[model samples]
Target: VVGAVVSITGVSSTVTSFGTTVRSDLVLQNENHMFLDISLWSDIARNLNGQELAVLGRSGPVMLAVCSLRVTGATKGGYSLTSTPGTRCVLNPVSEMAHLVQS
Candidate 1:
């Protein structure tokens, strides 16, 4: 499905992967009509928001996909897939990624 850019938001972090924890805010966003939201790490936060992003999610029998997004806020919303909001990087499915790039 195709969705327009909506908004990007920032969020706070309490720990890092290396165990060297630090508190920081990162940017995230919701795509067009998707119930899920996307967030980027501090290193890429600035470049992520308000940018068109392609996303994909999968389970045993369910698959979710989205294209184009607008990062919006700083607070964590209910749409996150990770335990910590805006901390983990979301991966787009390879098939969806190929579809997105080809279009």
Candidate 2:
């Protein structure tokens, strides 16, 4: 899915039986104004913390192209998207769809 970045939450950590788990919520909105929350896990979440994220959207709403996502039921209701190991994200993608979303 390709959408405009609305906001990204600060990285949060949780302790599980495996070990410490890190995640961040990246909220994106499509041209139709529908919102989707994608959970970015591990290194992907850590890399966007603090200043890095600000830089990404400093110019304008960051355009994102996300692939290989997993659909899961949200806690409150409905469904939310989650990043899988194969998930790939591209910022400011130079495509017609991205341009439409940007405008």
Candidate 3:
């Protein structure tokens, strides 16, 4: 999905039986005003956090394209997207759809 990043939480660690998983939460809003909360994992999460801060400092919205996410019900209610190992995230992507989302 393509949207402007509304907010990004700081990176944190979760200790699971499998090991330690680093994660961050990013909230995005599309042109239609729909909101999506995406859980970015590992390196992607940390990188996106830095990008969000940098772009926001310049007073520009952070445009993001997140793909290959797994849709699941959110614990509080509706639905949310989770990044898998295969998920891809691009910041300020150059594309027709991304342009539309920006405008």
Q: Number of clashing residue pairs in every model? A: 10, 0, 0
Top candidate when judged by TM-score against the true structure: 2
Better of 1 and 2 by TM-score: 2
Which parts of model 3 have CA positions greater than 4 angstroms off?
A: 6-21, 50-85, 89-103
Q: Report the C-alpha lDDT of model 3 over 39-99, residue by residue, as the tens digit.
A: 6555665465645554663464344444334433334566655554544444334564454
Which one wins by lDDT: 1 or 3?
Answer: 3
lDDT of 3 at 87: 43
Worst 10 residues of 3 by lDDT: 8-17
Measured over all alpha carbons after superposition, the RMSD of each candidate to the real structure, in angstroms, is 10.9, 6.5, 6.6
Better of 1 and 2 by lDDT: 2
Q: Clash pairs of candidate 3?
A: none
lDDT of 3 at 34: 47
TM-scores of all predicted structures? 0.26, 0.43, 0.40
Q: What's the CA error at residue 27 for candidate 3, in Å?
A: 1.9
What order do you get sorting by TM-score, best first? 2, 3, 1
Report the error of model 2 at residue 75, Å: 21
Clash total of candidate 1: 10
